[model samples]
Target: MTETVFQEESEVESLLSPLRSFLKCSTPKEWVEEAKKEKNLPTLLRDHLICELKAAQSAMLLIRRYAVDEESGKALLNWLKPYEDFTYRLVGDWRKLADYSSFNKRMVPKSRRPYSQPLIDKMVLLIKEELHHFYQVLEIAEELGIKYDKITSSRYARSLLSHVRTYEPAALIDKLICGAYIEARSCERFAAVAPHLTAKLSTFYYSLLRSEARHYQDYLALAREISDNDISERIAYFGEIEKELIQSSDDDFKFHSGLPC
Candidate 1:
């Protein structure tokens, strides 16, 4: 291989190293093999589109619930309305979604919490990028003649979130750590499946590595920032749960699904 190609591969490994260490296990080979099949491409892409929107929505919720005032919360909702309409209500032109990705409202923090601004800043940028990725996935789906159909969400996220503590900052911190695991797994699986896909698709998945890597870090950093005490124990606690979710048997075979049963 040329030096340029070798360098790119090295860079991708460097980016993924921390994510691999953060999670307890890599995605099973069985899952990757299933995901890369031609017959599974539509399901894969459809689920991916929803996953992107969900990621954006998750970040939006963090901001609206913990940081933004009433008006800014409304603005955040408006920013995502078109995408939600298209995805859930099936009521808008997906092609026009780019218009809605921009958020211009000044977000007034709800309180003097030191973590609020960092949370808002990181999550807002994450929301915009995820929504843009949603659009990119849609474009690829359209090119491949993959129609948008509502697919059931994988149990992955809900299951991880099921373990969240039902309290104040602890609840938020757990959710953030769950978010980190989710993002990290997504990045790991993207690299795992990229090589088996078409050149265009492989390149597209590779293109997402940097931003996805940053996203998990952002979630982890925010979690650490919000916690008064060390969060290492909590991070390890969730890591084992996330690892089981990835390595266990599952009948469903969406992007983040476990080994096919």
Candidate 2:
């Protein structure tokens, strides 16, 4: 009905086309039946809010660890200051007000950790997308009267980050690829959960949000761009790792877990 729908349809069809051929069965009938329920909205929204925060935190850690120098790390931290304050310190309404979200001062000296053109561009895109998602979650939380509470990091993020390499470019590329897995999985889950949510939230999740999809692709592209050879091995490497993390049980359930734990 909307351009967003058309775009998502095309992208999803392209991305999932290969997987579709392996599927002999359609979506389970139980899912369609459950889609008619009403309470799925608030329940999913609560999980989504936590997921949004975890996503942003994931990107933040990657950039802070690998993408920047000391000064740039401070700058990145400064960039996330308001969000950290809001989420941890309990700031004002972010939906109606963007207090300090300008990226005009993105400073990275050319001499220090000179980023490849593609890597810089893709990381910038991811940074933007993650921050925007953070804002959207804050808005939804505000509207729904959900009290934001401070919780320790969830196991999902910890597990994903644990697989990231601990060197330089390898670390950077692997982290980016890991980010891709997370975004791709999130996109998949949003699609999976959307059909069962309420009309409004379902529309919101399915709306013309350009960034999340970009995030998945952007991270993957950066990984390939930096790799010396074909990226499939590493891609498959992380995919297996990510799938295991998502498909297993855990003590905590956040944005990027396998199943309900």
Candidate 3:
């Protein structure tokens, strides 16, 4: 019986390892390669750090708008206070900030009774992981001497957001759809940037691809969960909009920006 149990655990781990591998591509290898490059480490790490903060900011906005209510929202704001205060200075151990980004909240109500538990669970976990990844990126950035500067806004977010409808559930649904677009684009960009970077950065970006892929799926899942009608129509609508944004020209040289303009 013990032997059977051990075998089952091993089999499960083996299956899950691939999923994990798919998330960041080759994180360990990328890290090793970064050490070898030496000269490029600072730039690469800074880019990664900013990306991580952007990711956390994305998650923060999501919960702030959709998940948290009045009182808890204040708490949430306080939780992120440290990062907001010290994106550059590192007043304290940044890793400790990871705990503040979880799903626990007294003011936020649970998922709507008839909603998709699977989707909610998945998204909550995605939020947690993304925040953790943000910390890892920051730590790496510190190691390489990168300073976090005020974000000047990227065209990537605004481009997809322009398509959001100007009304209630439809508005909410469209935003969720936009979320899907962002996650999909992030996944695509991660794959695109991987080869151009050093082994460690490539590995880290590659590692993110899978989670980023699933994030789009999660957003899509929620969009469907909220609507009784088939969501294929909505998905198709967003896909067209997403494609336009991806294929267009943009001035920013950031991660998800359009053709180098």
Error of 3 at 165 (Å): 1.5
Off by over 4 Å in 3: 1-51, 58-60, 88-113, 116-120
- Runs of candidate 2 with Cα error greater than 4 angstroms are 1-47, 64-70, 91-97, 112-114
Q: What tens digits encode model 3's per-residue C-alpha lDDT throughout 1-261?
A: 699768754754443453343332222333334434556455445555555565656655655666655675576567556766666555766667766666575445446634434433554577567767777777656664666554445676676678778875677678777777677666655654566665666667766766777777777778887776786777677676665555566554455544444
Candidate rank order under lDDT: 1, 2, 3
Best by lDDT: 1
251, model 2: CA deviation in Å? 4.7
Clashes of each: 0, 1, 11
| Cα displacement (Å) at residue 53, model 1 | 0.5
lDDT of each: 0.93, 0.61, 0.60
Across residues 203-232, which tens digit of lDDT does each residue of candidate 1 receive?
999999999999999999999989999999
TM-scores, each model vs. reference: 0.98, 0.76, 0.70
- For model 2, residues 14-46, the per-residue Cα lDDT tens digits are 654533332222333333334334443444455
